[model samples]
Target: MSLVNLEAVHKRFGEFEVLSNINLSVSEGEIVAIIGRSGSGKSTLLRCINGLEPVQQGRITVDGTEVTAANADLNNLRQRVGMVFQSYNLFPHLSVERNVTLALKVVRKTPYAEARDIAHEVITKVGLADKFGAYPDELSGGQQQRVAIARSLAMGPKVMLFDEITSALDPELVGEVLRVLEALAADGMTMLLVTHEMKFAKTVGNRTVFMHEGRIHEEGDSRETLEHPRTPELTGFLDAVLH
Candidate 1:
């Protein structure tokens, strides 16, 4: 069974349809990448999955829990779905350790010491053990984003949603962030990434989905989708971006 399934998903921002007739499924331990032009609803779809943006029609299910319903327990759902954004949204005032531990302590009611230990473990996994006491501004963009990922992992989420997480970084900083994500993918973390990193998408993703005009234009094995694109839209896009 699919870990996430969307059926006829639609979204509108005051009658301007943002997503139309979207249907997609992602299985557990799969890394799926969504690629499209800027306004093609790629980020909106991710937002909808995370409950950051409400869906106007159709259904979205994560681990079989419906996200489109008005009565869905958003807080509960959010805990299972962790998100990383283009900008690493770290709390400037908090140390890296505190940032990672905050959700555990506040939402899960974990004791402070226990949360701190858990935070340390995750930060270590992200290769930031020595920077635990550092603040966001003190770290490089790559380091800060790693902390952000560690924070999300500390939540023990079942799925991770990345919305152009490396788009804002310097060219030199991009690889470090991608390496962290690659490690996560290797560890079988179910991920849905909206990215312009074609190399990573083609190499790391189990599947690649092409979105155009707010709908899925095509989807298939990453190798085939990137190499022998079935749609004219996809062929044009890969040409413009890759060549």
Candidate 2:
């Protein structure tokens, strides 16, 4: 069964529609990369799925739970859905360990020792085992992004949503964060990401979705869809981005 499913979803800002009649399904462990222009609704789509944005129409479900239900527990839904953003939203004064454990300790009321252990495991998973004691400012942008990823991982979410997480990094540092995603992909973590990294999307994505003017313009196997785009819009987009 699909873990994430959206049917005829719609979202708008005043008269401007951000998402339009969207339908999508993602199975367990699948990696889907959403690529489009700035206003194409990629980020909004993720937000809607995670309940960060409210949709005007359609149903959304994650792991058989109806996210669109009137009384849906958004806070509880968020526990199953982890999101990482363009900015590493770590607390500057907190060590990586503390930053990762904060939600566990405060929100979930996990014991400090238990939270610390979870933090250690996820930090190590992101290859930051040696930097747990470091503060955010002390680490490189890439390392901080990794910490952000580790923090989300520590939540033990069923799915992860990444909103251009590497966009804020220096070009040279982008690879490190992408590598962490690659590792996560290898470990069968279901992920959906909005990204401008064409190569990474093709490499790590099982499917690639091209959105244009709040609609899915094209979607197919990552490598084939990216390499042999069937639509003028996708072709133009690839041409613009690649060259």
Candidate 3:
């Protein structure tokens, strides 16, 4: 079975449908990149997969558990599915180490020393080992975002969801965050990223999904899908983004 699965998913906000008949599957260690224009439901779909947003119809399963089920263990699901957003969302008052250790101590009830060790390990993984003592304000936008990613990694999630994670970074700093993601991909992390970085999506992603108007308009091998888009919508999108 796929590590993450969505079947005929439908979601709406009040009367406006944001997702329609969406079906997708992500296998273990696969990196799938989701691409689309604003309002195309990319972020919404990511939210639904992690159970941050409830779907009105269809099912979502992660690691063999149905996320849409009434009795779903959302806490457990969240522990296994980590999500990082465009915004860093780090705690300004806390040091980077504390920020990463907070959830481990609180939600997971890990002891302080162990949590600290975990934080150090993940911080190192994100290339921020020396910044552990720094506060959010002391770091650059890219560094703060890496801290956020480290915080999620400390949870040891099975799958990571990235919703335009580099969107908020400056052009010069964007490469740093993307490098961290590339490292994670190289380590065989299962990831689904909604990204505007066409180059990364094409090269690093195993599969690329093009969403259009709340639907999966096209999907295929990442290089093929980006280099030779099968649909006009995808072709136009590639043209607009690539050129």
Tens digits of per-residue lDDT, candidate 3, 1-243, equal: 799999999999999999999999999999999999999999999999989999999999999889999999999889999999899899999999999999999899999999999999999999999998999999999999999999999999999999999999999999999999999999999999999999999889999999999999999999999989889999899889887
Alpha-carbon runs more than 4 Å astray in model 3: none
Candidate 2 local distance difference test against the native: 0.94
- Who wins the lDDT comparison? 3
Instruction: Give the number of colliding residue pairs in candidate 2.
Output: 0
Q: Please state the error at residue 224 of candidate 3 in Å.
A: 0.5
| Clash count in backbone of candidate 1 | 0
> Could you tell me which 10 consecutive residues in candidate 1 have the lowest summed lDDT?
63-72
What are the TM-scores, per candidate, against the unseen true structure? Answer: 0.98, 0.97, 0.98
Pairs of residues at least 3 apart in sequence or in different chains that clash in candidate 3? none
What is candidate 2's TM-score against the reference?
0.97
Off by over 4 Å in 1: none
Give one digit per residue, the lDDT tens place, for model 2 in 1-243.
999999999999999999999999999999999999989999999999988888999999997788888988888878789999899888998999999999898889999999999999999999999999999999999999999999989889999999999999999999889999999999999999999999999999999999999999999999999999999999999999999
- Model 3 steric clash total: 0
Please rank every candidate by TM-score, starting with the best. Answer: 3, 1, 2
Q: Note the residue pairs that clash in candidate 2.
A: none
Cα-lDDT of candidate 3 = 0.96
- Report the C-alpha lDDT of model 1 over 95-148, residue by residue, as the tens digit: 998999999988999999899899989999999999989999999988998999
